[model samples]
Target: MIIRPALATELPALRTLETAAGAPFHDVGMASVAEDEPPALPVLAASLRAGRLLVAYEEGGPDGGLAGYLMWEPVDGATHIEQVSVAPAYAHRRIGQALIDRAGADGGDRPLTLTTFREVPWNAPYYARLGFRPLTDAELTPGLRAIRAHEAELGLDRWPRLCMRREAAG
Candidate 1:
């Protein structure tokens, strides 16, 4: 498998993956708790435009095929993982963890932080196993604040998020 930055041409596939990954959670209205909105294209576009999208794929596969992806940004000397998704068919295959591991490895000396839906089993504890611990709002820095603002503007629920952090490995 190979992990690398996303290319513009891969946006459609990413959107498809995002929609599929989000549907089950959305059906229960627990995925985001945000007001009804278009599926995932807008957010994906914004993340891509920011140059913060990374994709994972099996080497030698078709050019646009992806196993999973991580969307994040540099925040207060840490990498803030905004979202991670694997194609539904690809779940339980460690693609998500691989993306997280790649992010940590790429962070140099910085730490890694993320906010995930608290009730999602795959959100908090999954990261906890990797040494991330829950964090309080006071611990959030300016970059996190910006992220929070974006979420807020989108009407996303803030309390359901379990903010987490871990020091990067050297």
Candidate 2:
């Protein structure tokens, strides 16, 4: 898989890949999550414009189709990972990990942070395996707190979730 900044023309493909990636949530008893729409085109376009949207493409696979994607932004001195999704067909292939690692490299000295479902096997647990640790309430930065608040307002708090952080690779 090749990981690189997303092209403007490929934004729609990332949406499709994200929807496919979300399908597994249904089997995990979170149909609402599975059915949630991918980020809107304008939101994705903004990320792309910021150079924070990265896509993983399967080399030589059907016009080099997208296999996964990750979007992030700077928040409170950290690189806040907003989303990372790999198509089920590409699961366990390390595409998500590679994307995250790339983001860490790009983030330089900043720590990597994200909010995820605490119970989902591929959420907090998966991130733990990747070196992320759950943050205590006292550890939450103002920006992270706001992000969590927004998530709660969106009804994502129906399932347990928490913020996690991984120290910078540097």
Candidate 3:
């Protein structure tokens, strides 16, 4: 797989890809999540414009299409993982991990932080396997606290959630 910055023209396709990626949630009793729309076009465009988005394209196999995408934002002292998704057909092939690895590389030596579903196999558990650890409430920075508040306002707190952090690679 080859990973590179997302192009402006690729934003719409990324949203479509993200919707396809959300489909698996329906099978896991989280159809609401699957139904949620991808972030608005302007939000995606802004992230792309800020050079905060990256996409992984297949280097081999049919057509070498987009495998997945990841986004991050500098929040507090860390690079906050805003989103990461792999189209179902391309999942389980470490595309998500590769996107994350790219983010880590571009993160400027700051820890990577994110919030995720606490019980979902592909959410918090997947991240834990990648070296993230659940952060205690006491460890939540002001930016993270605001992030959680925003999530709560969005009703994402309906399900169990947790903040997690991965240290900068040595």
Find the candidate with the highest TM-score and give its number: 2
TM-score: which is higher, 1 or 3?
3
Model 3: per-residue Cα lDDT at residue 37 = 95
For candidate 1, what's the RMSD?
3.3
lDDT for each residue of candidate 2 in 1-170, tens digit (9 for 90 to 100):
78999999998888988888898899989999999999999999999999999988887665365788999999999999999999877789898999999999988899999999999999999999999999999999999999999999989999999999999987
Q: Which parts of model 3 have CA positions greater than 4 angstroms off? A: 60-64
Report the Cα lDDT for candidate 3: 0.92
Q: What lDDT would each prediction earn against the true structure?
A: 0.77, 0.93, 0.92
How do all models score by TM-score? 0.80, 0.97, 0.96
TM-score of 3: 0.96
Instruction: Put down candidate 3 lDDT per residue, 1-170, tens digits, no spaces.
Output: 88999998888889998999999889888888999999888998999899999999996654348889998999998999999999887879999998998899998899999999999899999999999999999999999999999999998998999999999996
- Of the two candidates 1 and 2, the one with more favorable TM-score, higher being better, is 2
Model 2 stretches with alpha carbons more than 4 Å out: none
RMSD of each: 3.3, 1.0, 1.1
TM-score (C-alpha) between model 1 and the true structure: 0.80
lDDT ranking, high to low: 2, 3, 1
After superposing candidate 1 on the true structure, give the runs of residues whose Cα lies further than 4 Å from its correct spot: 27-51, 59-65
